[model samples]
Target: MCLLLGVLVGRAVPWMQGWRTRAAHRAAEQKLDALYSQYDDIYHRWDE
Candidate 1:
């Protein structure tokens, strides 16, 4: 029983880490996109 539990945990830990990494990366990309959009809006308004 202990061995089985250990194996299950070993598999889950890496998967959970990968999921967290992807989530963080996606969040960062969204933030960068929003900043760029804001910059573009300001630039266009200034041009007018």
Candidate 2:
């Protein structure tokens, strides 16, 4: 039915958007953590 398809599509769009947003957030967090670790390593080396 057209109505059923419409409903399914409506629900799917938001779900897909949310999934993409979460994935992006996770990637950004990982990048930030990597950067922090690299900075920390450099700082430690400088201290020695």
Candidate 3:
């Protein structure tokens, strides 16, 4: 499943690299999981 998904994503990689695609990706990522913010907060909390 992961391998097939990788191939599928590979086919879309060019589109994913475009600015419009990136914006949509960002929006979808944020909606799916706030991993970016949580990751930053984890590091900052460790620093503190």
Superposition TM-score, candidate 2 onto the true structure: 0.80
lDDT of 1 by residue, 1-48 (tens): 999999999999999999999999999999999999999999999999
Give lDDT tens digits, candidate 3, residues 1-48.
999999999878777679677799889988667877887899999999
Highest TM-score against the true fold, candidate: 2
Model 1: residues with Cα > 4 Å off, grouped in runs: none
RMSD of each: 1.5, 1.2, 12.1
Candidate 1, backbone clash total: 0
lDDT of 3 at 32: 64
Alpha-carbon lDDT, every model: 1.00, 1.00, 0.85
**Native-to-model Cα distance after best TM-score fit, residue 1 in candidate 3, in Å:** 45
Residue 29 error, candidate 1, Å: 1.0
By TM-score, is 1 or 3 better?
1
**TM, every model:** 0.74, 0.80, 0.35
The local lDDT score (0 to 100) that residue 19 gets in candidate 3 is 66
In model 3, where do residues sit more than 4 Å from their true spots? Answer: 1-27, 31-33
Worst 10 residues of 3 by lDDT: 13-22
- How far residue 4's Cα lies from its native spot in candidate 1, in Å, is 3.0
